[model samples]
Target: MPTKSGSQRKRTALLLLLALTGCALRVPVRQLRLPDKLPPEELGALRAIYLVLRLADAETASPDKLSRAVALAAEIRRALEGPSSRVVAYQITASDEPADYFIEQSSATGVLWLNLPATEPDPPPQEVDASTATASARPVEASLKAPYHFYAEPGHRLILKDSVSAAHKSTSTAENQRALARLLAANLAKDLAVHPMTLHRVVEEGGEPELKEAYQAAKEQRWPAAVTLWKKVSTALSDDWTPLYNLGVAQEKEGRFDLAQEYYAMALERENSKSRPRKSTLRRLRNILATLNRLAPSSLEPAKGGAAHIPAWLRQKMAVLPMSNETVDIEAPQVVRAKLHQALASRGYRVLPLQEVDEKLKEIGLTDGGQLKAYSTQEIAKALDAELLFYSRLMDFRVIPLGIYYERVVQAHFTLTAAASRTLHGTRSTAQGAADTGDVVLDWEEKVQYQSVSEPKKWAEALAWQILERQVSKILKVQLKEETEILVLKCVNKLPAYFNP
Candidate 1:
C-alpha cells in the first residue's frame, strides 16, 4: 500500500543508519584501474642513478682501449637523458686512475663487436691430416660477460625483478649491454653497508666511551671540552665521521663555512649518508654556500631537494597557530577549534565560528600535537562537518637542541596533517641537522658567525616553519616521497569510516 517515494525514502534512511552504525561497506578499490602503463613523469623520477663504477683494468684500456673507454663514457652520458629533461652529470676521476666503468663492446651495424685485439691473432693448428685436401677453421667469439667492479652507496639493494622492455626501474643504460648488466648487478649488491676498502681502515676501533664523553661535554655548553673529547674519540673511533660532523657544527656555529665545508666533506666520506642535511641544514648551509660561492663557486651545483613546493590554492588556506608561551596551554579544545575557525576563514576557506566545533571537541581534547592521537576522524568530521580538515602541531621541545647545538647531532620530528572525512593526506618530515662535527675549539671563534647556540636559532626555527608551510602545500602537485606507513599510528587508527580498511 506504500507509494514508491515512501519506499525510496525508507531505503535511504536504512543506508544512512548503516553508515552511522559503523556497518558501512568498504569498496575494494586499491589496484585502481591504472592506465596499462606508467606516465612519463613517474618514470622520470627514478632515472639518472648515481653510480660508483670501476673498470677491469686501466693499462690495457689506454690509447686504443682508452679512446674506446672515453668514447663509451660519452655515449652513456648522452643516453641517460631522453628527448626531455637534461641529464645533470658529475664525474670525479682521480688523476691517472682506471676508468670507473667501461663498455666491453660497441655497436657495429646491428651486432655488437667487442673491443678485442682489433686485429685477431693466429692460433697454432693442433693437427694436420696429410690425406685431407682442405682444412677448416673453428669459430670463436668474445666473452660478452666481462667482469666489472662496482662500489655504490651502501644500505640500498637493487632487486633484478623481471626486466622491462623499456629499461623499467633503471637509473641509466650503458651504450653496451654488458655495462647495463653490471649496473643492475651492482644495485642488487647495494645492501652491503661496509665496503671492503672501508672495513680495512677501522683497525681495532674501540672508543664509544670517548664519543659519549664528548657528547656530554657539548651538552654542558663546554665547547672547549667537547672539541678535545671529540678529537680523542675520533682517534679511538677509527677516524669516525662523528667527530667530523661535530666539528662541522662547531665551525658552522663559528660562521666558518669555508672550514665547515671541509668537515662536511669528511663527514660524507662515511658513505650513503641519511646524514645528508635536511632543509634546515641546507638553508643554513645554503646561506653559507651562497656567501662562499661568491668567493670561489665550485662546479658542484647545489642540490635542489631542500627547496619547498607550495600550490596556489593551499597558499590561500594556511593556519597561523598561536605561538606557545609557557603561560597559555594549547591543550584545551576551544583553543584548537577557535584557531582552526579563524585561520581557515582568514585563509579564504568557508568555515563556521569556533563555537560550533567546541561541543564536539569538548568530549576529547583536540588541542596540541601530542594529544592528536586521542581524537577520532568520525568525531572530528562530526564536529566540524568539514569534508577536509587541517591540523597543525606546535611543539616546543626546547632545552634539548639547545644542549646539543654546541657538540652533537640534534634530531627534530615535525608533522602537518591534512585530512578528509575518510581520505587523509599529510607529511611527516624529520630534521636531523647536526651543529658540529670534529676535533676543534667551539668558542675559538664565537665573535665570528655560524658558531655557538644563540639567538640566531630563532631565525633558524622561522626558516624551518617557512619550509614546512611550503612542503605541506605541495601535496596536490608534487608526489613527495612521503611514506604514510611511518605516520602517527594513533591518528591512522582513527581515520573516517569511509577510509577504513
Candidate 2:
C-alpha cells in the first residue's frame, strides 16, 4: 500500500513509459506518391518498321500551298526518322512511285500521303431547325477546318488517317507554316510509332529543402544540378521512391535508357501498393524494356570493350568567359553563355562550371562583360585555371514588329585562344576593308523576316475581331530564347573538333 503522493508518481511514470512505447512503435506515413494521372508518351517507337512519305497536292492548290506541303512532308520525314522511331529508313519522293514500289525497293512497310488543300475551308454554318426549336435549343457548331490531311496506307488497307492544324495562329505566314508543319509531324509520328510519354513528378509533403530545390532545377532543364541534388536526397532517404523515379526520368531524358530502366525497377521494388503511380511506372518500364528487346537485344548485354579513351585536347580544361554584350538585353549574354557551356560539355569538352568561373572573375573585380576586354586573355585564363579560353560578343539581338511584318536578328562573334601560345586560330575576316589583326574564329549572323502580304486586310479584320471578342490577339512576334539557342548551336557546331579519333 503506497501513500497518495507515491501512487500519483507511479501512475505518471507508467503513462510516460506507455507514451514512449507508442512513439517507438509508430510508423511514418509516406505522403510522397505518384500523381493519379500521367501524361501520354510524347515520343517512342511502337514497332521496328519503316514507311515512305509522299507529298501530294490538290489541282487548285497554290504554289505557296505546294511549297508548304513540301515543307510539311520534310518535317514529318525527319520526325519519323528520329532516334526513338521504329522507322529504320524512310524515302521522301514527289514522284508518282506507287506504294508497292517503295515497299519492294526501299524496304518500306507503308506509304504516307500528305495532301495539301487549295485553301482552308470555311466552317459550315450552324444548323438549327426553327420549326422544332425550343427557347433553350442551341445551334450545332461546326468544327474548325484543318489545312493538312495525312493518309497512312500500311500493306493493302488504309490503316490511319487524320487531319491536323497548326499549333497556333501567327502574324507571320512563314512562322504559321513552320508551326503547322511541326504540329502535324509530331501528331503523325505519335500515331505511327510508340514515343516516350511524359511522366508526372512527385512532390513530398513536408519534405526537405533539397528535394524542392532539385525539383525546381529539373523544371528549369538543369539536368546536371538536378541529378546531383536528387542523388543526395536519394542517399539520405533510401526507402523513398520519388527521388529514384525522378532519377529515372532524368536519365531517360539524357538518352541513357539502360540506366533509366534499372532505376525504374528499383523504384517499383520499393514502392508500396498504396498508390497507382506504381502501376504506371511498372507499365512504362515494361514497355521500354520490351521495345529495347525487340529493337536492339544486344544493347541489353554488357559491352565487349571498356569505355573509349578521351583525347588530350578534350581532356584539357576550357573556359567560356562572360560574353561582351552590345545589346540592350542585359540577360542575353548569360543566356548565350549557358547555352555555349552546355554545347561544349555535350561535345566531350571539359568546360569549367559557369558559377565557379564567375566566382573566380568576381575575386578580381571583373563582373561585367565590358570589364573583360580590360584584362589580358592570359591573365583571365590564369585566374580561371583554364588551358583554353573562349570569348564572345553579342553584337545584335533585336526584334522589330511593324503591323503584320516582323524582323528578328541575332549576331554573335566568337574567338578561341590557346593560353599557352597566346595565339588565335581562325580565318581573318577582310569584309570590313581593314582585316582583323587577330584571326577571327567565328563571325556569324542570322536574320528572319516575315511579311503577310496576301491577307493583310484579313489580318486586320481578324485583329479587330479578336479585340472585340477576346480583348487580345494571339500573335507571338518574338522568341528570343529559342532564337538565341539556335544561334549558339550553329556557332558552336563550327568550332573545330580537336579530337584525333
- Model 1, span 1-501: residue lDDT tens: 855698899999998887764432111111111112223222222222332222334322223333343444444334332322111222222122321111101000010112222222233233445689566433322123222222211222222122211112222222333443344333322221111111001111125777666666665667688778766766666545667667666665555556866766655554224555455544443443343333312222222121131212232222222222222222322333343355345434444445444444555665443344455433455555543334433222111233224311111122222222111123222211111111110000000012245356375675555455434634442211121111221112111101000
TM-score of each model, paired residue for residue = 0.18, 0.34
Alpha-carbon runs more than 4 Å astray in model 1? 1-344, 364-370, 397-501
Off by over 4 Å in 2: 1-309, 422-455, 458-478, 497-501
Most accurate candidate by lDDT: 2
Query: What is the C-alpha lDDT profile of model 2 across 1-501, one tens digit per residue?
Result: 856698889999999988856433121211111111111221212222333334343222334554455465556656555333334233333334333422332232344444443344232234456797733322222222233222232443444456544454544445555766787677656555433444332332217788778877765667689889888888898767778777876775565667867877776676644454567656765654454333222222121111242223465688888888889877667878898899889866789999999999999999877787667666777788987667777888765544344445667777665455322222223211111222222333433222333267566664454344322211342346666766665555434332111
Collision count for each candidate, in order: 24, 9
Q: After superposition, how far is residue 281 of candidate 1 from its true place, in Å?
A: 62
TM-score for predicted model 1 compared with the true structure: 0.18
- What's model 2's lDDT at 150? 25
Candidate 1 overall Cα lDDT vs. reference? 0.33
317 in model 2: Cα distance from truth in Å?
1.1
